[model samples]
Target: MNLFTKYLHSVTLSLSKGIQKIACLLLLSIPLFTQAEDGYKLWLRYDKITDKAQQSYYAPRLKTVYADLSDPSVKVAADELQLAVKSLLGFTPVVKAAGTGSQGLTLTIDPKTEGINEEGFSVSTTPKGIHIKARSGAGVLYGVFNLLKNIQTGADPNVTSSPEIQRRLLNHWDNHNGTIERGYAGMSLWKWYELPERIDPRYIDYARANASIGINGTVLNNVNASARFLTHEYLGKVKALADAFRPYGIRVYLSVNFAAPRILGKLKDADPLNPEVQKWWADKTKEIYDLIPDFGGYLVKANSEGEPGPMDYGRTHADGANMLAAAVKPYNGIIMWRAFVYAPDPKGDRFKAAYEEFKPFDGKFADNVILQVKNGPIDFMPREPVSPLFSAMEKTPVSLEFQVTQEYLGWATHWVYLAPMFEEVLKTDTHVKGSGSTLSGILKGDTFGYKMTAMAGVANTGSDRNWTGHPMTQANWYTLGRLAWDTRLTSESIADEWIRQTLTRNNAAVETIRKSMMKTREIYVNYTSPFGLHHVMGEGHHFGPEPWLDKAARPDWTAVYYHRVDSTGIGFNRTATGSNALAQYPGGLVEVYQDEATCPEPFLLWFHHVRWDRPMKSGLSFWNDFVKHFYEGARQVQDLQAEWQSVKAQVPPEIFNNVEARLQTQYKEAVWWRDACVLYFQTHSKMPVPAPYKAPERTLEEVKKLVDIYHIR
Candidate 1:
């Protein structure tokens, strides 16, 4: 070859090598861009603060951390602060054992401390540094989280707080085989197959997230429990999880099958009165406590949905609860007996079933037994009067059980922020004692002077990369923990805090997201169950619309039973002439609910049936207003999409894209709900689509077929 040709070949090889190096450098930098917004960290994301002024303020305050590392939880707290400081303030704090110095942050557990309970903590800024004092190690851990949260949100750190309820827990409806009942995010966070021998690091992250939100206990199995979970095999798996979570100040609880003695112990009848059954339970409780000394307790769903209870043996619920209470009382564990019992009586009002069954045995419950009542009378409807039992059960400790998982609120597909619903239910005046007797006060054991109090949220978390399926749904889990810790907090304040921590801290972006989140629940209710229409979704999965679901396994399970849509009008009449369910409420609510004129419009159809021609307060005919809500809800979802689009530049690309896709699906579903409900209910009312609003593009038959496809599984 010629010399000039050789020179050209060498030049080409050098250029190719340079281009490869550039490509490799770019590939290496991809993580730097993606890691900040992948959402795997949840709201606990401690990415470095962008504002230099805020970083300067926090760095000096947390220069050195000193805590008594004797307790495992306290050591975790110390480690957590150091890690958070390094991430948020760009410097690792010098963490040291206690008694080293009082010049920096000092965390102490002092039983003699005033104005704080066992799990409460007080943080105050001093001349030397910040000092945190709590009655126990758990409190120190909570205080550390509280301080970090303040720094993250750019708030003053001086605060004293305690969980108003004794036990704040998340009940997982997760089965033994890794499938969660009504869970939409993914299969389940607990890898049952890999457990006991191989502990998943995700378990620690779950514990950290729960502890950060002040959730202290978790029911690790489904309420529709399998007796296999009670076996020694599963107990060993639970112990491994308990060991991982203990350092985070989280205790593990189990949801037991009431018929465990019959299924697992090979007993006959499994009667609460039977000595063999009693002995079996006592031994099981002792065995569980032996493996997990800090085992919280048992959550039982008995005599509900065909589950076994003492009633199967001709005994009352109190008889069943007291038996289990006796077994756990020695270990300071409590029994949370669910009051979700109902029978398939075509002639009976399902709303009155729970109140009838549980009210008579209010004071009969054992001291350690807390009757767990759902927030609504009928299984977590979009909206309902707070359960009447919340007013009637004055003697028994009643813990409010809220569904954080959106089983009835469109599951993971629809974006519904539930804190508002929770706030509304909690603030409602039960008026059992007097006018000021709110459900919040009742759960706090304040009005009734009960010995113990607790609150449980049916967990929404799963194995999804973002924890909850929709990016925004994480706020619901956050809301549950915050409200369970202190019900008095306004939903708006909690949303603000969550937005600042989880999303971008830009003021404009925060407001836009907040407005959309705050309106989400109402928007969902409007589209799906406006004017108190409920249980009208597709059966089984509870997705889309099924206003024409007149036939089901039972009459009460069908939509026709609740809506009562006949040729004359719509809505179930629960007044004196109807079911008289209003009589179960306090006298004040009974008087108001009985009168259509005085009953709130939101609950209008829930208690009374009115004619289609009747005029509403909005001056539109009943049918028109109802139809208007459906259309308005669909339009609002479009608005939500627009609002989300407006904040695209401010949000991280991956999170922004993830939420954008969900919002698009939500808009389409909202339209589906609108078209389906309007078309089907229009057939009964025999009315037009109303003026200025176009009729659904599809026929009723077409909409029904779509719902049929959705329920094919």
Candidate 2:
């Protein structure tokens, strides 16, 4: 009986061991079968290199990492390199303290690196090994990410980067109730109910992504702010997030309500001149610094869009901003006072409001205060001339505030690459000091010679797994960060880099994607608001086309108010004969904009109202040219769809299918815009659809019904 029992135990154990070995073998092969890529990792996917030559070259060079282990940021940089090397090269790199050996990649702090600023980095391939040096630990982390990005794109591991703007930030319009103002991605990323107790791991990932892109700060709440964010309860929550982001070099900021003293502190008044109000802000600033020592200061949206400001107390914007600036000055914090104001005067051009208001008090702002101006005079339209305030404010330090979110460019549904739009505005000549006085130069303190410089993007990020709603839209966010870091980068180069890292490394696919991205913004402008017609979107929601919209609470908020269409002609006359808003610009720009014959066609209708039968530079009559732009714009979308489809085999199936679906939706919407605008404008122009372009099957009334559905809000 003992011999049989022993034999049975030996047989069972042998079979169990064999099964375990087979299971482990199968588990090892899982990566080969998993080809579906859901784009949760936005541009930081460190998948193994497909090119054998690149793998061979990078694998040996990154075999070890040498960095100082004393700093937390340096440790993070080393760990990130180890993890990236393991995933991309399929081998973990040995990370050791600096001076261990020079054979491997070395991370060093070099204060004398030329062109490398405080948070700037320089990387080079040396005879000893790869060398990465920066002035700070944050710079070291950025260098590591840049090195990995170079490896992924098969580029030379040599780069020197310094941010053009001092405080590059993402301004989140996320609310405490988990809703975003103009966000189309999803709900807010910050989980207020569980924060300060149960921090989500996503917070760390977010900070890591921002650091990699050279974004140093984030405003955690909507600018249409709530006073509750200043309370102790929310400050504790914000402090927890600050701690999570601090390791990755991201400072946290809050959008404070101007009436917080009255609302949160229960003060009788919120006047900037009041001593009690001044003391309250100082105390609040001290409280914030105590909780989060490295806290970035407030972003204010006072006296605009129903928000209360010092104007309510018979004071100026400078009076308000300087008060807050003085409060945080001891703590070395700054105030980003928004210059997005527009008055309710129906006769005055809204385009001239901000310039007139801010230009008067340019040098009155405190040293710690920066005037954050939008890229365009109007809102973030598809196309508009650069703000006149940029040139007029010589003594003020104005920062460029760009909207990375696609609010007017068909929010999340259409594929409009905004880098090109940003490039257009940045390259626009202010002509104040001379022809070379570009918006980029102004923001960099080269033109105005102001102290501080900053660039802020209204972020499009949300709780979507892809970060941005459309996977391709992630490029917009990436582009903003890249441009903020180095304004000299071309839109075309940014597109190429983004496509290689985020979508495909295949050369053919990258070229095809790059071309499409370059033209997407113009296509959007042509279809939606061709010839400088701005803010012609559906009232309230701003979703579908509503060129016929005339009724609204404010005249400036309506489409007809902007387009100013009548039986005789179309376009707003901002020239000498009309509102004379073109005079707001410098004399050189004013001359170009005042004349119909000399003005650029893109901005022709913005400044002058011409006859429908008047001849255009395009050789077509005004009405015919307008119709052609609308038709050609929609037609270009079809071409873009075909171009995208040509690279189907080159892209990952998940991304290919996702983008294809959006492209289809984009084409449909493009046609909708063309048909709606053409039909509505025809009521005034009384022109036919012209040769080759067929008339829309649906009437203007039919399209109005569709607009009604979209304007439920």
Candidate 3:
């Protein structure tokens, strides 16, 4: 018999009969060779390297590992490296404690490191092995993950990196009742019914995934929060999750109800200025910090969308936020007050609501309060201008909030990569200081010299076997974490890295997939809301085409309210003549956008209404150009399908099948969007469909009927 089989047989023979059965069952549970590709491992999947040259190169370097295990975070890092080495190099490394080794990796926590921040890490290589030095245990953990990523991508290991933002977080809009608002992946990850007593193994896996990508914080509940989360019963459950995640360096945060004083304490009225109300919040915050010592703090979505806030008591948002900030200050916690507020204005621009509301009270907030603003002015539309608040708020620290969930990008069914969108917004010159002052620079605190900086993504993860329903959507989650850690990373580079680690390492297949992924966001934009058309989806579901939607409970929620399509032309006049939202931008951008000819074509419809017969840069009229983009977008989906087929042999069968099926749905929906929008807008423009492309097979009326069916409960 082979040596492994002989050893196993002898070991089993030594065990008692019951112990032998248990050992056999344990052995059977773990595959002796390889695990199935079910996508649960995410980007950390350390599959055995099939490339002989790479194996030969990495095997020697991972012969031994030495790391200080005094810190729990560093212990997890050592364990992770050991696991990865065994899976990738085919043998477990000799793990030594608190000492240097002759070969393999060495992780050290050096508080006196010259350039590394608390959460940053530096990796250097020598003939003996690689060394990862960091200022904190969290940094060592981050360094370990980065080193593994470099090995997986076949990149150089000698690199020094730090997170540009102070806090990188994921805001989970998961309700207490196990429902996730706009979560398309599946049910909520937190099993509220069985927490504190029974800790699900999935919680550890979730923490591992987040830590691998450098996400340090997570908000546990929806921004439309329930006060029960602050109750003693729920605090115990939250404390249990915090304990499980602490080893991975992830701090748990909570989304709090602003009126918890009145709702839970049975106070007569909840007012920020009231001493009784302030004391209630102080007591609640103390109770929370006591349970979870490292609690990240609270995310407040108040005075917006009918939620209770100090505004209800005729007090300002600052009055409310500062009170909470003071309550958490003793525990070193910060308050993330959301600036996603908008009043029901039939004539006003929804894009200007947030800026106007918060800009006036810029310097009034407490030191620990961070005004969280969405990437765009309006809700997370497929395409939107960077919010004016990024430039307007000069005194208070502001954090960029991006929606990693595909709420407005066809939910989870459509294949849309959002890294490009995030990159575009980050790189756009806000002109806050001068010509080179980009949003990324502002967010990094380089341009503004702000006290704190952060980036929060509305999380898309759920309880699906694959965290995100669409297997490819996991890239969005990875992109957010990487960008949050370092805003300077290009979307192209992130896509390439993710494709190599998660999908395929084959160079040709990686390139094919990368190219396809890079084009998906723009392709989705073209078919759905090209040329800066925002909020055109169906009312509640936000799925199919709804460019024709003229009625809703609120005017701002309707598609026509923003588009402003008329017999003369189509587009919102945000310049001086209309909402004057352009004036809110810096003088340079205002001048650029005020004129129809100078404005970028992508935002042409967003800023000014132009004649349908106006000549476009492509030498085609506006209407003809619009029709071309619609057709081209639909055509691109077909091209993506063909490209995906080319890489079938490289991707796993389950992943390939999942993506292939999603592509079919995306293609069908793209066609529906193209046909429905072109036909519906034609009614206003009084123009026929441009030549070279035939009309849709289905009529506008027929398309409307289909959309109605989608809106059904």
- Candidate 1 residues 1-713, lDDT tens each? 45654554555556678885775565445433224576778788886788887766666668888878888989999888878888887788887878536568988989999998999999998755888999999999999999988887888889999999989999999999999998989989999889899988788889888999999999999989999999999999999999999998888989999999999999987899999999999999999999999898899999888888889999999999999999998899989999999999999999999999999998999899999999999989999888999888888989999999999987887889999999999999877887888899999988889879989999999998888898889999999999988899998888888888888888899899998899999999999999899889777777778888888888888888899997778998999999999999999878768888878889989999978988899999999999999999999999999999999988878888888888888888899999999998888899998888999888889888886566543
Question: Candidate 3 clashing pairs?
Answer: none
For model 3, the superposed segments whose C-alpha errors exceed 4 Å read 1-35, 711-713
What is the Å distance of residue 221 in model 1 from its true position?
0.7
True-structure Cα RMSD, model 1: 4.2
Using alpha carbons, what is the TM-score of model 1? 0.96
Q: Candidate 2, 365: how far from true, in Å?
A: 0.6
Ordered by lDDT, highest first, the candidates read 3, 2, 1
Per-residue lDDT for 1-713 in model 2, tens only? 35644455455556678885775565444444444676778888886788998876777678888889787788889988988889888999998778636577989977777788899999988654788899999999999989988898888889988788899999999999999999999999999999899999888888878988889999999999999999999999999999998878899999999999999889998999999999999999999999999999999999998999999999999999999999999999999999999987777799899998999998999999999999989899898899999898888899999999988889988999999999888888888886777889999998878889999999999998888888888999999899998888899999988888888888998999999999999999989888888888888788878888888999888888888898888899998889989889999889778889889989977888877888988899988988999999999999989999999998878888888999899989998999999999899988899888999999888887886565556
Q: In candidate 1, where is summed lDDT lowest over 10 consecutive residues?
A: 27-36
Model 1, which residues run further than 4 Å from truth? 1-36, 100-102, 711-713
Poorest lDDT segment (10 consecutive residues) of candidate 2: 26-35
Evaluated with TM-score, which candidate comes out highest? 1
Scored by lDDT, model 3 comes in at 0.90
Winner on TM-score between 1 and 2 is: 1
Instruction: Give each model a TM-score.
Output: 0.96, 0.95, 0.95
Best by lDDT: 3
Residue 584, model 3: lDDT of 90
